[model samples]
Target: MTTTYRVTLRNRNGVPLDVAEDEPIYAAALRAGIQLPIACNYGGCITCAAKLITGHVRQPKGTALNRRQSQAGFILLCVARPTCDCVLDVGVESHRGLYQNPFAIAGNRYPPDA
Candidate 1:
């Protein structure tokens, strides 16, 4: 059995969405009629960047964020999977100035190759 998590989307006004432990938040949000900023679906860009307001997310394949950035509550929803119930502020690609830049990047350029 898969563990399902409830993620409250701030952009959607506290609408609740469910996602399996192994399912990415992006996919789950879409299924719940919620849309988040997204570009490279492979986790190479900040287009799908979001802020983790509370709880935890498993971003094992998300390369757009380094450990420091993740620790700062930043997460790429396109590749983030909820580990437990969480609250997230999505569609935050335009808020770059609010965050400090990371010295190390785990991904390629803006538009990652397929």
Candidate 2:
């Protein structure tokens, strides 16, 4: 039997998307006809930045998030595949001002100080 985990992703409006563990969060959202903030699907852009509120994910090595950001629970939905059930907060509003750098906040550029 194949095992699959549930992933719940939320936006600023408290909207939630149910994603699959083996799929990228963005792709799951797209498959469900949900429009999420995304630029590059390769994890170069921070447009798809999200916070991992619960559970775990296997993020691509190319993800723009730094060690600090990763430790702080940041994940790139475009390249993040859930390793288990997960809950992610999407968009800058979801960050609640934890990150100050526009690039880091936006998930596009990595801050040197980070």
Candidate 2 lDDT tens digits, 1-114: 445677775554445655666678889878877777788888886778788889988877545876767777878888888787777787676555346656545764544433
Per-residue CA lDDT of model 1 for 1-114, tens digit only, reads 999999998767789998999999999988887777789997888778888889998776677775555556788888889999999877764354335533432363222211
Q: Which candidate number maximizes lDDT?
A: 1
Clashing pairs in 1: none
**CA lDDT scores, all candidates in order:** 0.76, 0.72
TM-score of each: 0.77, 0.72
Candidate 1 Cα lDDT to native: 0.76
Q: Which stretches of candidate 2 lie over 4 Å from their true place?
A: 10-18, 98-114
Error in Å for residue 5 of model 1: 0.7
> Best candidate, TM-score-wise?
1
**Looking at candidate 2, what is the lDDT of residue 84?**
79
